[model samples]
Target: MRVPRFCCFLLLAIAASAYADSEIPFAAFELADSTDFTTNAEKNLWLLAEAAATAGDTAGNTQRASLDLRWEASLNRQWRAGFSDRVDGHFSQDLKQSDSLNTLREAWLSYRLTPQTLFDAGRINTRYGVALGYNPTDFLGRGTVRSASSADPEMLRSNRLGNAMIRVQRFWDRAALSAIWSPKISSKPATSSTSLDWGASNPRNRLLLSGSYRLAENLNPQLLLLQEEQRSPQFGANFSRVLSRQVLVYAEWAGGRQPLAWQEALPRQQWQVRWRNRTAAGVTWTGENQLSLRLEGHYNGLADNSRALAYLSAAAGSGGGQNTTPVVTEWVAPRRAALLQAYWADIFDRYDLNIIWQRDMQRGQNLGFAEVRHHIGPVDLALQWQKVFRLSTHSRVLAQADRRWQLSIGYFF
Candidate 1:
C-alpha cells in the first residue's frame, strides 16, 4: 500500500509539470504564429500606435494617441518575463503633454503545483471577464488608461498585485474558484466620501468571487459576486445552451450595489438581464459576415433616494488618474423617488459596442451609440459614435446631450 501511494504521488507531480509546460508552449506558439508577441530572441520588442477623434456640442477632441511596446522573454517554462511600456500621447487639444513608460505588465513565475494550482506572483495582468473577450461587459477593465479617462469610472483596485497569492484553477472542471486577497490597498475609508485611490485604498478587505458549474450537457451556469467596495456586489447568474447549429443563447440577470464609491460603497440595488448569440468565439467563425445580437435591461433600486446627480457632478470635477476622489461632494439629495430602468439593443460583433443607459428614481434614460469594425489580414479599422442624455432631474433640470466619435486604424505583426 505504501509503495502504491508513493508511485501515485510521483505521477501527479509529473502531470503538474506537464500542464505548466503546456501553457507556456501555447503562449509561445501563438507569439510565433502571428497573434503578436513574436520577435527576434535578442531584441524581442513590438510597437503599437492608436489614435481617436471625437466630436459633440460646442466641444470636440482629436488626435489622441498611444505608443505601446512589449518585451517578451520566456526563461524556460517556469519563468517568463514581460515588460509593457506605455507612452501616452494624450493630445486632446486642451490636455497637457502626457507621456511616460510604465512598469512591467507581467513579470512573474508560473510554477506547477499538482497539475492544477498555479503560483503566479508578480505584477501580472488578470482578466475576470468571460471567454477572455475584449468587451467590458464580459469582464470589467480595472487598470486601463483609456477606460479610466471616462468622466465617471468606478473605484477600482490597481490592475497588478504586489503581494504574493496563489491561484489554483482546474480547467473544464465541475466547478472552479478564482479569487485574490491581497495587501494591495493602502487605506480604507468608511464610505464613499472618504474613499481612497488604489494606491491609498482603505485597508478594508476587497475581493471578487466568480464560479461556474456544469449542470448538464449543453447547459453551463455561472455566477459572479464581487465585493469591490460593498459587502458583495449584487448577484448575477448566466446560462448557456445550443438551440441548433446556427443558434445559441445566453441569458443572465444581476443584482448588486453600485460600485462607484470606495468609502461608502453604495449598493446600486439593480437587476440586469441580457441575451446574446453569435456563430463563434472570434470574428466570422462560420461565414464571411457572421452577426451577433444582444439585449440587456437594468433596474436600479433607488428607494433610498437617487444621489446620481451629486455623484456625477463630483466625478466631472475629479482629477488625478492615480488617486481616489470623494464620493459625496455636496450634501445634496434628489426630492423624488423612482426606480431606474433601461436597456441596450446591439449588433456588429467584431469588437462589439459599449452602450450605457442612465436614469433616476422616477424615470429612465436612453443613450445612443453606433459602431463598425473590421479586421483584414494584419490591419484593423474601427469607427464609433456615442450620445448621452441625462433624464429627469429634481434639482438640476437637464444636462445637454453629449456625443463622441472615434475612427482608428491599427497594424499588428
Candidate 2:
C-alpha cells in the first residue's frame, strides 16, 4: 500500500522531539472487522448503476487496522503547537491500493498575544454548532471528507481533513470574538491516497467572523457571518440553555441565498438563487442512572425531493452511459428529518451502550445504528450494528446497505 512517506517522517520527527522534552504523545491502535448485507436495488437499472459507480460494492466484509496519534506541546510560555493524524489500512478480497488512507486532521501553531488573546496559523479543524446529529452552522465542513470508516456523525466529523487558515480570537469575562480567513489553494481534489488534497478542504477563499455573549448563568448565544468566493454571505446563530442539572436544549440555524440542492448536483442545470434556511434543534436529558437520551429535528429549505428524483429519472432514461459523470449522491440531505439517540455509560461495570435512530420525514426512510462497548484497562472492545430501510430509489445511496455489523478492538498507549 502507498503511504505518505514524507508526512509520516515529519510526524515521527515531531514526536521524537516532543519525547526528548519528557512529554508523551497520545496514541492508539485499533483493529476492526465489518460485514455488510446489501439490498438489491437493481429494479431501477439506472439507479443500480449509479449506486455502483459512486458507492462502490456495498455487500462485502473487510478488516482494517488503524493508528491515531495526537500531540500538543508548549513552546516556551507564549507559543504552542499541536498535531493530529490517523492512518488506516484495509484488507479484503477486493482491497485496492487506494483503500489505504492517511489523513492529517490538524497541525497548527498558536501564539498567545495576551492572557486572553491568541493567534493561530496552519491547518485547523474549526468546528461550530451545538447539535448532536446535524450541524447547520458548520460552514467550513462542506466537502472536506477524504475517507469514511463509519456512519456515526461523531466519527465522521472527527476523521476529516482540516482547512488551512489564519485565525485570531479574543476572550473576555463572559464574551468572545473570533475571525478566520482560509484562502483557496488547489482547483481540484487530489485522488491519490498520499496526496494532501487541499482543494477538497479549501475550494474557495472564505472569511468568517463570530462572537458569543453570555446573557445569563445558563444561556450563551453565538452569532456568525460567513462569506465565500462567488457566493452570497450566510448568517448563523447558535443558542443553548440549561433548564436544570438534568436537562438542556439547543438550536442552530444558518440562512443564505443559495441554489437548489439538485441544481448543485446535476451539471449544466439552470442555476437559481433564493433565500434558504437550514436548521437543527435538539434537547438532551440525563438521569441519575447515567442514561442519556436526546431528540433532534432538522430542516433544509433548499432540498427539493421532487426535483432530485426527477433528475435521477431523467439521467436513467437517457442511458447516460457508464462514462457519464457520476452523480453527486452526498447532497441527499432530507428536507425534514428527526434523530433520536440513547447512551448508557457504565450500564454494567465496564460496558456502555449507545443507540441512534434517524428518519427522513419527507420520504419515509429510516436509519438505525447501535453499539455496545466494553473497557478493560487500556483496551476497548466494541460491537456495532446499522440498518437502513425504504431507501431503494433515493439519492442517499451511501447508506443503502440493508444491514451492517462491525467488531473492533483497540489499545491505547
Candidate 3:
C-alpha cells in the first residue's frame, strides 16, 4: 500500500497517545472533543508536498502537492456551518504531464433543532461502520479520488469526496435514530446538446434509515435499512463491545442482492443475490508497550471460487477487453477474507512501524505490507514495502507478484 507520508505521521501521533488508560481509542476522544458546543469557530490551513519513485519501466517517478483549507462558523446558538476546500497538483513520469484540480470537499450546514434533535444538509461525507481496515456496512464505500497512483492508505481515506445529502437525527438517553437521503448526481458532464440523460438514468439515488442503541455500558448495536432507486432494499447491522480496558471486539454483517457474474454464453441476470451474506468480525488489542494488534476475519458468500476461475478463464479467452462479458470483467474475489495487523508507536518517541498480512482464502493468495515512519517536527519521512504471493495459482499471474518499495518525505504546515 502506498502510504501517504503526512497521514502516517498523524496516525503515529494518535497511536502513541493511545496507550493511556482510556476505554476509547484516541480517535474517538478526539472526535468527541471537536464537537463541543463551547468551542469557538475557527479556520485552519494544511499544506502537504511529497515526491516518490516507483520501480517500473514507465511512470517510475511522481510528485504531488496539496493545500487544504477548513473553516467552521456558528451562525447562531443552534446553527453551524462548515466548509473545506482542497487544491491538488500532480506530476507523473509516464503521463509526461502535470495537472491540477480544485475540489470542494465539504460544504454543510448543521442545525440543532433541539437539545436532542439535529439536522444536516448539503454536500457531506457520510461514513459508517466500526471496522478499521474495511467496513462492509459503509454502504457508500470510501469516496473515489482523481488518481490511484499514490499508495498512502491514510491519504486515500481522508480524501473523500462528498455527496449531496439531507439528514435528520434524534437522540434519546440510550438510543438514537437517523434518516438520510442522498440524491444521485451525474457522473459525467453533460454534452453540448444539453440532453441531461445520464442524471435521470442513474440508479444510485437512495435513502437510509438507521437506529442505534446502547444495550449496556459496554455494548452498542446499530441497524440500517438501505433503499435504492431501482433495486431492492438491503439490511445491515453491527455491534461493538468493550471486553476490557485493553481489548475491544466488533462485528458487522450486511445482506443485499449484490451483483454477480454469469457464464458468458449463458445469458444471466446482471444482479442477483446469489450470495447475500457479507460479514466481518474482529478484535483489537492495545497495551502499554505502545503496541496494537488487530485480527479480523471476513466472509463474503458471493465469492464463488469456481465462478472466479471460470470468469478468469473466459476473460483470458476473450482477450480480456470489451469483448469480455461486463459481469465477468467486474467480478473479483473478495480481497480481505483474513487479516492480521500490528502497530508499534513511539519507538524512541519518534518512529513507528505498521505491518499487515491479508489473505484471500478462496483464491489462495496472500499479501504482506510493512511501513515505517519517522517524525521530525512537522515533517514525516516514510518507507513502505509490499509483496504478493499466490499459492495455488499461476506463478506469473499475481497483482503483487513483484516486490515494490517506496520512500517519501512529506512536510505539513
Most accurate candidate by TM-score: 2
TM-score of each: 0.55, 0.80, 0.76
1 against 2, candidate with superior TM-score: 2
Q: What's the true lDDT of residue 92 in model 2?
A: 67
The 10-residue segment of model 3 with minimum total lDDT is: 32-41
Candidate 3, residue 21: CA error in Å? Answer: 19
Per-prediction tally of clashes = 19, 0, 4
TM-score of 3: 0.76
Expressed as tens digits, the lDDT of each residue in 224-318 for candidate 2 is: 99999988999999887768766767889999998875576445347788899999998877676656678999998777665666666565556
* Better structure of 1 and 3 per lDDT: 3
| lDDT for 14 (candidate 3) | 36
Sort all candidates by lDDT, best to worst: 2, 3, 1
RMSD of each: 12.3, 11.6, 6.6
> lDDT value for candidate 1?
0.37
Candidate 2 regions exceeding 4 Å error are 1-57, 94-98, 265-269, 316-331, 388-399
